[model samples]
Target chain A: MSVTYLEAIREAQTKLLREDERVFIYGQDIAGKFGGAFKATKGLAEKFPGRVLNTPISEDAMIGTAIGAALEGMRPIVEMQFADFSSIALNQILNNAGTHYYRTNVPVPITVRLPSGGTKGSGPFHSQSMEGLYSHYPGVVVMTPATVEDAYTMLIDAVAIDDPVVYCEHKYLYYHLKADALPKESFPVGKARIVRPGRDLTIVTYSAMVHEALAVAGELQRDGFEIEVVDLRTVKPLDTQTVLASVARTGRLLAVGEAFPWGGVTAEVISRVTTEGFQLLDAAPARINAKDTPIPYHPNLWSEHRPNRKSIATKARQILQE
Target chain B: MLQTAQRGKKSKKTAPEKPASKKGQVHERYVEAFRWMLTARILEDKLASLYRGGMIVGGVYLGRGQEAVSAACGIFLKKGDVFGPLIRDQAGRSAFGEPLLDVVRTYLGSVKGPMRGRDGNIHRGRPRENELAMISHLGAMIPVMVGKLLAKRMKGEKEFVGLTTLGEGGMQTGASHEGLNIAAVEQVPLVVVVTNNHWAYSTPNEREFACANLVDRAIGYGYEGHKIDGTDLNQCLEVIETAVKRARAGRPPQLVVAEVLRLAGHGEHDDASYVPQEMKAQPFAQDPVARTEKYILENGLLDEDKLKQMRAEIAKQVDEAVATAQQEDPPYPREEDWRSMSTDELIDKPSF
Candidate 1:
C-alpha cells in the first residue's frame, strides 16, 4: 500500500494505541468522524473510543492537561492546530512540562504534534518552525521527522520517551512525501540519515529542507561535483558526530533549514561545526535560512522568503568555490 | 514573631462579616482539620526561622492566614481526587497525603530528596504520590488539575474530582480564564478555588479588578459561583464538600472565590507596608487557627494542655525532619549527569 507522510503518522499512532493501553490522542476537532484539523488523526477515534479525545478550543488547557495526564502515567499526544498557535501554551510546555522531570524526577511522557513550516498563503499566524525555540530549553526533546518512515517511527519513539517531546512535523511534507510502505523497524532516534553521499560539500538539514537539499544535490550531480545531504531526525539531541564526520570528509559545510535565521537550527548546526570541528573545515561553515521576517501571505513572497533548492544550490556553489 | 495586629496592611474597605458558623461542637473530623492547620502553621513558622537563619537559601512563602481554606479543601478531597497545590497550600499538600519528611527534604534542598535539589521548597509535589506539583506561574495549575481530572475520569476512575487554587490577583491571568472556560464547556469534574486575599502583591482589591467579587466571574463562564468566609473552617469545608460532590456527580465545574487574609508579607522579603494597618489586623482578629483552637476548647474536645501537647509534638517532628534533612548533602549536577541525562531511561533503551 502506498503510504503518505500523514498516513504514516496516523498508522504509527494506530500502532501505539493498539500496543499501549495508556496511549491516547487529544486535540481540538480530532475526535469522532471529523478526524483532525489536518486529518492527521483520521479514523482512529472510531477504533479507540475514549482514548481519542476532542478537547475544547483552549491551547493552554490542551497542553496543560496533557502534561497532567503524562504526570499521571498516561501518554497523551497533543496536536496544536497550527505551529504558530503553540506560543499560547509555551508556559505549560516550556516551564511546567519541561521542568517537571528535572525538578521532581517525574517524567512527563507527552508528544506535542506541531504542524510546522510554511504553506502557500498560510500567513504569519498559521506558519512557523519552532523546533529551535523548543530545543533551547533544558528538558524538552525536539524531534523533526523528515521522511514518511521517520514520521511513523519517530512518533512512536516520542510517546515511549520519558521526557516531553515537541514533534515538529512539517505541514508541506504531509501529503507530498510518499513511500511504498512504512518501515518495520527504523533507525534509533537522534541519528542523522545521509540522504545523499558525496565529497564536494556536506548539506546538513532536517524536515522539509532535507527534500530541498536532496534536490539541490541531484541538480549539482550533473556537474560531476558530488554533494552530501544529511537529515537530522531529531534536533535537540542533534547528531553532531554525523554532521562533523560528513564535514570531515567533504571539508565544506552548508547548513540549511526553512526556519528563521536568528538563533535557529541552522545557526545552531553551523555554530557547533565551526567551534568543534574548525580544523576539519577547509572553509568557514555557511548556512541558508529563511529571511528574518514573519512568513508573508503571498505565495511569491513566501517562495522567495524561505530557502529553496535554487538558493541552496547557489550558496553551495559559492561555498564550493571558496 | 511579629504581633498578629502588624501582619498585613489594612485595606480601606472593611472585612466581610463572619459567616454564622455552627455553634460550639467540634467533631472528630473538625479536630483533624485543626491538627492539619496547626501542623501547617508550625511548619511555616519553622520555614520562616530557617529563612532568617540563612538555612533556607530561597525565599519563604506561607499561607499563614488562609490555612482554613487550604486545610478544608485538602481534607474534603477523596482518594481519587487530583489537586495542584500552590505555594501557599502546604497544609493542603500535607492533607493530600504528601509526607512531612518529603516537605522538609524539599525545603532543605536535600540531594537525596524527591526533587534531587533541582527545585525550591514551594515548588515541590509528588504526583506519583497523587499530588500534582505547581510552578511559580500563578493560575497555571488550574487547567493542569482540570486535565488530570479529565484523564482520571476517562480512565474509568469515575469518582475522581480535581482541586486547584489561585489568588485574586492571579484570576486576571488568561490561563485562568481559558482553564475555567474549558472546564465549563467540557463539564469536567473540577473545583477551582480563588483565594481572594484582596491584594496582588501591592495591588489592592479595587486595583486588582473591576468586578465586585472574583467568584462572580464564574457567571461569565456559566458555572455556579461561591463567595464563602475563608476564616471559618467549618463553613469552608461545608461549602467545598457540596462542590466536591457536585463535581463527582459529573456536573459542571464550580468556581469558589473564598475571602481569605494574607497574614504575612508575600514573601519573607516584603514587610507588607502597602497593606493598610486596619486590613492587617482584620485577619488576625479573625484568625482561623485561633478560631479553631477556641472551638476545640469550648466544645471540650481538648483543653490548653492537650493543645500544648499537640504543638510540642509537631515541633519535635519538625526539628527531627530538619535535622535529618541537614545531614544530607546538597545537590550537585555534574557534567556527566548533564550530558547523560538527556532523555529518560524508557526511551534511551537501545543506547547505541
Candidate 2:
C-alpha cells in the first residue's frame, strides 16, 4: 500500500506512542472522535486512548503546558491547528521552551507540529510557513520534511531530541505526496538530500518547494540543462557544507522556499553560499521566496503569493544563464 | 461557583494548639513561615544593597508585604507538587526547599549555579525537582503549571498537584484567562495564587482592573474564588491549606486572590513614590512578618532571646552565602563544547 505524507505522519506518531510510554499528543480537538483539524491525528487518538488529549482553544497554554510536561520528562507532541495560529503561543515556544535547555541544561523534549504552507484560500492567518522564524531561536530544531518518508522519520527523530523542535509540515503535500511503503531507514537529522543531480545549476529547497524545484529541474532537462536539487530536511542546523559542495559542482545556486521573502531559509542558503563558497560561484547565488506581502485569501492571489514551479523554473533559468 | 466576598478577619494574636515535629506542627509551621518571610525580606534587602553597590547585575524584586501569601502557599504544598515562583515568591521558594545559598548563588549569577550564569535574579528554577522558575511573561506560567500537573496525573501519579503565582496585572492577560479555563475543563489539580499586590510595576490596582472582585472571576470558570487579606498570616495559611486539600481531591482549579501590598518599588530601582499614601499605609502597618512576630511574642510561642538569635543566624547565613557566591566564576561554555552541551547528539562531521 502506498503511504501518503499525512498517513506517514500518523504512522510515525503511532510508532512513537507505541514505543515510548511517555509519548503523548496534545492539541485542540485531537481527542477520540474529533481527530484533528487536518486529520493528521485521526485514528491514533482512538488507538492511544488516554495518551491523546483534546485541549481548550488556548494555543498559548497548549505550548506552555507542553514545555512544562517536557521539563517533567514527558515527550509531548503539540499540534498547532494552523502554522499561523502558532504565533499565539510564540512567547512560550520561543522564550520558555527555546531557552530552557541552554539556561538550565534540562532538556525540553517537546515537538510542535505546525501544518505550514499555503493551501488554496487558507489565507494569511492559516497558510504561513514559520520555519525561518523558529530556526532563528537557539535551542529549537526546525525540521521541514519534504517527502513521505522524511515526514515519518523526522517526526520520530524530533520526539527523541532533547531540545524543542518545530516540525513544519506543509499542508499542500498532505495527500499530494506519496511513496511505496514507509522506509525503515532514512537520512539523519539536519542533513540535506540531493534529490536530483546535474552539473549546470543547484536548486536548494525544502518542504513543498522541494517538489517544485524538482519539477523545474525536470522541465529544464528537455533543453539540455542539468539542474541539481537539494532538500534541506532541517532548517536550524542547516546543511551548509552539502549546499556549498553542490555550489562547487554546479557553479550556480538558486535557493527556493514557500515562506516570505524576508530573512528566510532561502536567504540563509544564499548568504552561506556567497560567504563560504564565493569562489565556487560562476555567478552570484540567487533565491526565490513568497512575495513580501501577507498571504492573500483569494485563490489566484494566494497562488501568486508563494513560489511555484513556473516562478522557480524562471529563477533557475536566469541563474543558469548568468 | 461560590462568590462571597469575605475580607479576612483583622490580625489578632491567637495561641493555637502546638503540635509535635520541628516543621510540621501548627506553631512550628508558623514560626518557620515567619523565618522564611524574614529571610526573604533580609535576602532581598541584601540583594538591593548589592545592586546599588555594583556587586550584582540585573534587578532585585522583593516580596516585602506578600510574604504571608507565598509562605502559606509554599508550606501547604505537599511533596511532588510543582510550583512556578513569581518575583514576589522568595519566601515560597524557601518553603519549597530551595536553599538560601542556592538562591544567593542564583542572584550572584555564579558559574556553578542552577542557571549556570545564563540567567540572573528571579528567573531561576530547578525543574527536575519540580520547583519551576518564573519567566518574565507573568501570566504565561499558569498553563505551564497546569501542564506539569496534567503530566503527573498521566504518568499515574493521580495525587500530584501544581501551583503558580502571578500578580493581579497578569490576570488581565489572555494567558491567565486561557490557563484557568483549560485547567477547569481538564479538571487538573492546580491552584493559582494571584498575589494582588496592588501594582503591576508602576500601574496600581485601580488602573489594572475594573472587576467587582478579582477572585470572583474564578466563578466564571466554574470554580470557587477565595479572597483573603494577605497581610493576615494566619488567615492566608488557613485559606491556602484548604485550597491544597480541595485540589488534591481532584477538584477544578481554584483562584486565591490575596490582597497584599508591595512595600518596595517594583524593583530596587523605583522609589514607589507613585503609590498613594493612604493605600500604602494600611498594608504596611499590617506587615505579615510583624504580625507573625507579634503573635509569637504576645502568645509566648518563642522567647525574645531565641527570636533575636534566630534573626542573627539568618543574617549571618545570608552574608556568607553572598560572599561565597561572589567568589565563584560566571559560567562561560566554550565554543568547542557548545554542540555537546546544547543538543542531544553531536552531529557526525557533515558529509560533503
Candidate 3:
C-alpha cells in the first residue's frame, strides 16, 4: 500500500529482470556504483551484476548499444540522465532503434526512460517535455505515467511490447506519490486511464499534469464545477476513443500538460478532438499547458512555464463558461 | 536527420538453400570460397554498371582487390557469427551465403531485395545468415557489432562473435575510436576488420592520421592487432579464424587489419580519375579473385576449364537474380508505417 512512483518503476524493473533474462538496464551513473541519480535503479545493479551496466559518457553509444542488443533478442532498458539530453541520441532513437524493426523487419524491443519534466531547479537542459517531437516518430511508443499505480503498471505493459518505447518519467513525480501494492505481473500499455471521473468537464492530462488537474478539480468542485481527469498513459497511438467519450459526456474539454503550448502534445489532442468530436464539444478544446519557452531556473518562473492548479482551474472555468 | 530504419519480425517458411552457390561448388573448401568471390565480383561489377547507368541510385564503394577478405571471411563465418560489413561487404554478404540471387537482386533493386527494395545498395543487411547490411556511414557499425557481441555473450552464446569491417579512412573517424575504446574496455567479442586500402576518398593514409597502419591504433586500444595482406584469401580467412578463436577462448576482442587497395574510386559513382593510375593498376596486378584463380589453376588445384565453368555458373546466376530483382516491386507498408506508434504497439503488436 506504500508504493511510490519511484518504487513502482523499480519494482517493474525488478520483476521484468527476474522474469525475462533478455531484459537489461544500462546508462551513465547507473549500476551498483551510483544507483542512478534518483535511486530509480538503486538495487538493480547489485541484484543483477552482469545485466545492469554503467556506460561511458556517450549517449549515442548507450542508445546504439540498446538498439543493437534488442536486435539480437535481448531487451535493453536505457536511461537518459535527463529527458532533454535525449536529443544527443536523437539519431539513434529515430534512425536505428525506431526504424530497425521496419528496415530489418525484426522487432527491436528497446526501452528508453528519461527523467523528465520541470523540477529540481535544473534549467533548460533538464526540464523539457518533448512528447510532441517524439510522438512524430513512427514505430515508437511513448509513455507518461501519472499515478503510482500507472507508474508501476505502465512499465510491465511496456516490457511486453516487442518494439522500441520512449518512456518519460517526471523527475518530480518519483518520490511525490504513493499508491496501493504495485502489480508484479504483466500490464497493458496504450490505453488511456480515467484517473478522476467527473461529469461537468473533462480534463485531459498525464504524468505530473494528472496531479495538477486533480488538485484543481478538488478546488473547483467545492464551488460546483465537476471535472473529469483523463490520464493519457501513452502519447503515440493516442487513446482517442477515451478522449472523445469523455468530451461527449462533459461537452467541455481542457487539455492540461506541463509541455509547450504551440505544437505540443495538447495541440495534438485538441486537433484530433476538434476534427472528430467537434459536434460533441460544447466549446473548442482549451489547452492549459506550459509556456512556449525553455523552463527558467527561478521557482516562480518555472511554475509560470508549467501549468499549475490555478491555471488548470482557470482553464476549466473558461471552458465551462464557453 | 540520418535516421535508422525500423523493422518488425514475421514468421515465414524456411528459405531454401541458394542454388547460385550450389552451381559454383566444385567440392573443395577454398575453391568454393574462390567461386563465391567470383560471384561477388560479377555482382559488384554489375552493380557498378547499374550505377553507371541510371538504375542503382546510391553508388557503392567497390571491394575489388579485397575479394579474398570477402572470400575467406564468407567461408570462416559460422552460424550466429554476425558480419558487420565493410563499405565493400557486398562480396562478404554473398560469401556468408546470402542467397547469391537475393544478393544480386538487392543490388538490382528487386522486390526480393533484402530490404524489399526500400534499401538501396548502401543500406543492406540480413539477420537470417548473420550478416548485417552494409551501412554507408563508416565505422558506425563497429559499436553496433560490439553491442551485438555482448548480447550474444549475455545469452550464453559462446560461439557468436561480431566481425566489423571498415575502410582505412574509417581508422581516423571518431566512430573507430569510440567503437574500439568500448570494445577494448568491455572486452566485447568482436573482430574489428580495418580494410586498409591506403586512402580516404582522395586523401592518402599519410595525411589522414598519425599512425602508419590502422592495426597500430587497435594495439594502442589494449587489444591484440594483426596486419594481413587483404589480397590473400587464405591469410584473411586464417586471421579471422584466429581472432574468432581468441575471442572465444580469452573472451576478449581482437582486431584484424586487412591491408588491401582501393581497386576503384570511393564509390561506383566516383571514377578512379582522382586516384593515381599507378596505385589502382598496381593492386589490380594481384586481383584477389584472379590471384585465387591463378592459385587454383597454377597449383593444379583446378584447371582453367574448371575455373571457366565456375565463372559461367556465377554469371548465369547473377543474370537471373538481376532479372528477378528488376521485375520485383518496392515494399508497400501501411499508413501506420508513416505514423507514430504507441508503447504497447511498439512492444507487442502494432498493426504493421
lDDT of each: 0.83, 0.84, 0.75
Clashing pairs in 2: none
Write model 1 residue lDDT over B179-222, tens digit each, in one string. Answer: 88877766778888778877788788887789766776775786
Per-residue C-alpha lDDT of model 1 across residues A1-322, encoded as one tens digit per residue? 7999999999999999999988988898999999998999899999988889898778998888888787767899999999899999999999998888777777788999999999999998888999999887767888999999999999999998878899999999999999999999988877888989999899999999999999999999998889999998888888888888999999999999888888878888888888788899998789999998899999999999999889999999999999
Is 1 or 2 the stronger prediction by lDDT? Answer: 2
TM-scores of chain A in all candidate models: 0.99, 0.99, 0.96
Residue-level lDDT tens digits of model 3 in A61-107: 67777767877888889888888988877767877767665666666
Error of 3 at B294 (Å): 4.8
Q: What is candidate 2's CA lDDT for residue A133?
A: 90
How much is the lDDT of residue B258 in candidate 1? 80
- Runs in model 3 lying further than 4 Å from the true structure: A183-187, A260-262, B1-30, B51-61, B134-137, B169-176, B198-211, B232-234, B276-287, B290-301, B327-352
In model 3 chain A, where is the ten-residue run with the lowest total lDDT?
A180-189
Off by over 4 Å in 1: B1-26, B281-285, B339-352
lDDT of 2 at B154: 82
Model 1: docking quality category: acceptable
- Superposed by TM-score, candidate 1 places the C-alpha of residue B168 at a distance from the truth, in angstroms, of 0.9
- Tell me the interface RMSD of every candidate, in Å: 4.2, 3.2, 4.0
Candidate closest to the true structure, highest DockQ: 2
Each prediction's DockQ?
0.46, 0.53, 0.34
Best by TM-score: 2
How is the predicted docking of candidate 3 categorized under the CAPRI scheme?
acceptable
